[model samples]
Target: MTDPRWGEAFSTAFAQLTALWPDKVAIGAAVSGLCALMETDVALAYICFGALTADMTARVAVCCKRNRPLCRGLKRALPRYVCYLVFIVMAWAAQVAFQRGLHVGLPIVDIMLAYLILTDMASIIGHLHYLGVPVPPVLKWLVFGGREQLKRKAREAAGRERR
Candidate 1:
């Protein structure tokens, strides 16, 4: 018979790993860009990038619980992710509006995807900030203004909890 404690440990490890999967996929998207072969299909590459970035943004939202909108029980983080989804939809719609309505020369796919890359970077850095991880100078400015914003948010949350 399998040891119950061992089974519990395995279950816990699996849960943690599953929770981390989105972050790993985001890192994979970054590493994929380094591969010359993937560049051959530029359109597909951009689509993949767009999809990954949208997912990463939502996943990052799911990761940061303290600052998230209030929801209850098993699906508390879900509403927060929905907010990120709205941002993704709006971004795509803006790209369409800019290209079709205004008759700009911009490629909608490329522009929207490139914008999503920036958004993903911001979310990734934000996640790092929430985790108390050290981030580089560029990402610092891009995400939280050198952790001061994070510190302020933390202080605000503490004050609220004290009340």
Candidate 2:
């Protein structure tokens, strides 16, 4: 049996990892850029970036407590990632309004938004399996299998607890 301390260590490590992942940083960058574009102020934009990061970090903590390893997985994070899309749309609208010109020029924002959304969704699908959340068969084949691993560990942990 794993030591209780191991679980704590794992939790701490995973929490730190989730906070520092590339996807989260990209989301923060989106918020930062949006604030910068809207206010014409770099500092204010960075402040907004920091706020979003902090908020996400808190949410991760909540998710960890509520769902454990499954929360740390991608499925839960994927749904939550929808917020990033909302941020992008809001930013685009603000930019269009501020410029007062119908400039739909392609920007780095589009690429970032697309990559972030796709990657986050992929992770979420994997995590959903860990939680035994039924994903469509089409998606199940696409995601890395996590259901059995999570289920085995969950059952083992429960057995230990009952002993």
Candidate 3:
């Protein structure tokens, strides 16, 4: 006959294992989902970085055409690029932590990414305008502000100058 103590020990071990199985499965699923989300975010960040680099290149080209010192323009731009890169990385990390740890449903990361994209687009549009490319007035209004706002500001400045 089988020993009673051995049967009891085996049953106890199986019960404990089964009890912990759901927790393990939950943790595994969370980690898997987080990894997938992180991968998507990384790809998007790379695209944002590419846009920023293009903007920087356009600025440098403008500076070069204007007979400015290339080194000075690059020196001014390099720090800004580095800061943006750091911001992207930090934003990714913070987003992951908040979304997973705090269970936040807010779209903070999406807003940040959109802001970066819009800023780069505005810079590119400005550079194109400087290069004598005829960007549509509507684009300028959309990216910078409405034409009425600009006119108002100009009128205010002129009014101040007369005083």
Q: Which has the greatest TM-score?
A: 3
Worst 10 residues of 3 by lDDT: 105-114
For 45-162, candidate 3 gives per-residue lDDT tens digits of: 6566677888889889999989999887788767877787566557668767766886654444544555676677788898999999899988977866643454465467447644
* Cα lDDT over the full model 3: 0.71
Q: Name the regions of candidate 3 deviating beyond 4 angstroms.
A: 1-43, 145-163
lDDT of each: 0.54, 0.53, 0.71
Q: Which regions of candidate 1 deviate over 4 angstroms?
A: 1-104, 142-163
Candidate 1: 10-residue stretch with minimal lDDT: 34-43
- In model 2, the Cα lDDT at residue 41 comes to 44
- Give the better candidate number (1 or 2) by lDDT: 1
TM-score of 1: 0.34
List per-candidate RMSD values in Å: 14.3, 19.5, 19.6
Candidate 3: RMSD to truth: 19.6
* TM-score to true structure, per model: 0.34, 0.29, 0.56
Per-residue error for 13 in candidate 2, Å, reads 19
